[model samples]
Target: MLYINQQKSALQASTLADLAEQLALPTQGVALVLNRQLLPRALWAQTPLSTEQDHHIEIFQLVAGG
Candidate 1:
């Protein structure tokens, strides 16, 4: 079980990258955080997310407008 932005989700993954893919979210122009910690893009593929673990994950997207 995982709580993304305080919303309950049942998705499990071995890495942050995998979790993003499973959620079908755009990897570009976005950022991921775990437990109030900033997650780097380069580390996403190695960062861990497990079914047995409960975490507070947040994704922030950058929007550009002029």
Candidate 2:
């Protein structure tokens, strides 16, 4: 099971990119924090989530306003 923003998500995804796709989270204005660490966009496709344990994925949205 994957824990996203402290909420459990049943969406099946191995990588951050996949997770974003499944959750409908925009990759352009979002930042991912996996396992309490910042995840680089370059590594999102390569980084794998562990199935043996619950993984924490925090999504931070960046908004622009004037």
Candidate 3:
């Protein structure tokens, strides 16, 4: 099982892109971090999730404020 935003998740995904899709994340104004590293949007499709290891995925929403 993997952790999403510090919460336990049973959802299984082959790639980062798949995970994002499963979560219905916005295309913009959001950032994804995997294993303490910032994952670029372009790499999401190529990044694979390993079942052998537990992963930690963090999603940060971009906000605009004064």
Per-model CA lDDT versus the true structure = 0.85, 0.84, 0.96
Q: Lowest lDDT 10-mer window, candidate 1?
A: 46-55
Off by over 4 Å in 3: 64-66
Q: Rate residue 10 of model 3 by lDDT.
A: 97
Q: Is 1 or 3 the stronger prediction by lDDT? A: 3
Q: Compare the candidates by lDDT and give the number of the best one.
A: 3
The sequence of per-residue lDDT tens digits that candidate 1 reaches over residues 1-66 is 788999998777788889889988886888899988998888889888866768899998978998
- Candidate 1 — which pairs collide? none
Which residue runs does candidate 1 get wrong by more than 4 Å?
64-66
How many clashes does the backbone of model 1 have? 0
Ranking by lDDT: 3, 1, 2
Of 1 and 2, the candidate ahead on lDDT is 1
Superior by TM-score: candidate 1 or candidate 2: 2
Lowest summed lDDT window (length 10), candidate 3 = 57-66
Q: What tens digits encode model 3's per-residue C-alpha lDDT throughout 1-66?
A: 799999999999999999999999999989999999998899999999999999999999989998
